[model samples]
Target: MQNSIFKTAEVTDYIVQWLKDYALTSGVKGYVIGISGGIDSAVTSVLCAQTGLPVLCVEMPIHQAPSHVSRAKEHIAFLQNKFSNVQAVEADLTPAFETFKNAVPPSDNENLLNLTLANTRARLRMTALYYFAGLHQSLVAGTGNKIEDFGVGFFTKYGDGGVDVSPIADLMKSEVKAIGKYLQIPTSIIQAKPTDGLFGDDRSDEDQLGANYDELEEAMLAFENGIQATNLTGRKREVFDIFCRLNRINQHKINPIPVCKIPKELK
Candidate 1:
């Protein structure tokens, strides 16, 4: 996590270095980021831009997307105006999302409508990202952060989380915000409470988690810093329990499915 003195040269060094590390790991020429007019996307776009690679900031808006799309465009324009090699692309997802919803059979899992809808948006965004990546020979710069990953298994599996490289995946939500501020990302984006924005306006990542980022941050610190929780509140303990069950249940989502392979010579 980033310590204080957000706009210091050291902070910039850390951000740039993280981007370089991901580029080395993925061997990607550039980055394609799903920019949602939110802090995570803004910070990621800025960091990737700082790496001196071309950046594709894409907006994949489903039917439920808000005026935020315009906000997204403004942010993308800011990136292009201020930085080099930043291109903006908008991909409409209304038809694809509706078609998938229409195709789902009536009897297939009645209880997971919100889940299905959210996953649908995420997967569609992924489809667009991968296509853009193929065109540019770049890696998808994923927007998920450590706080979201730790709490309640919130992100859609292999959907938004599907990416060749993730710059902010290791940082907590506050850490992400601190970096965003240091990077001079738009304050509206920085202050935006994150939502998957998959479902209608009623949806939010924190709401789904049944716990907010503060609790999530505490739990993450407890695990990472080996800190004692002697003064932990009852609500926090409840949130911790939720995190525990979620970490266990969503383990499958985090890991790639296994397949048994016979030796080629045996054939």
Candidate 2:
């Protein structure tokens, strides 16, 4: 297979310029992003900072792991030192999550309950971002990559997927990492395992998706380009099957929400 690698500096410059143009034309004051200490968020925040516009990096922890918070702080500090426009804030959502979760109807299905609560965590973070965005007239920057956003629909609708602009949404996971390295984001964050941070546990993106990002990205690239999953063999076939199943099941997320169209005659 041909190399899937991207030109680090070129991609970084493109995204940086994209952010600059977006803020200029959109008339937003600045950028607001949830810095989850994951590679995608770290890279997105750095790109926003590079635009020389005021960027607020909010660490909205909801029963967050110590390591995740630590990495987030580290990245925040790193960017603040490098860019005058970059600032960090903490919005602890643990109390909100607790209040919200307590009100949910009790369920015998632990899995269903956990999933609902996890999605709640994401929505709360989204709410916090918008709260500040409205206050500062800024836009919420999204961090989902192509694989998660378009392939598996790994993001919670109107939660992590909620944003004003997604600078890296077109890029794959591998491409995001490449840009992360080029931007000199903290090595610890770039190398850290990816997570949604909504589960309140240390479960990773791979664990939830049932496939590693590299495998999923490759399979998805093929699938989107009209390559059939049935054409693969051996381990490739396994990965393709996982990708296909996820794409089929989560297709709703990437598709337009169904709306009833009334007939003109009836009207």
Candidate 1: give the clashing pairs.
Answer: none
lDDT per residue as tens, model 1, 113-187: 666777878988899999999999898988888866644456777788888776777777878888778778877
Overall local distance difference test of candidate 1: 0.78
Give the true-structure RMSD of model 2.
1.5
For candidate 2, give the lDDT of residue 71. 93
Best by TM-score: 2
Show model 1 residue runs off by greater than 4 Å. Answer: 1-11, 21-27, 108-110, 224-231, 256-267
List the RMSD of every prediction in angstroms. Answer: 3.2, 1.5
**lDDT per residue as tens, model 2, 112-215:** 98898888889899999999999989999999998888888899998998899989999888888888878898899988989888877789988988888998
State in Å the error of residue 229, model 1.
8.1
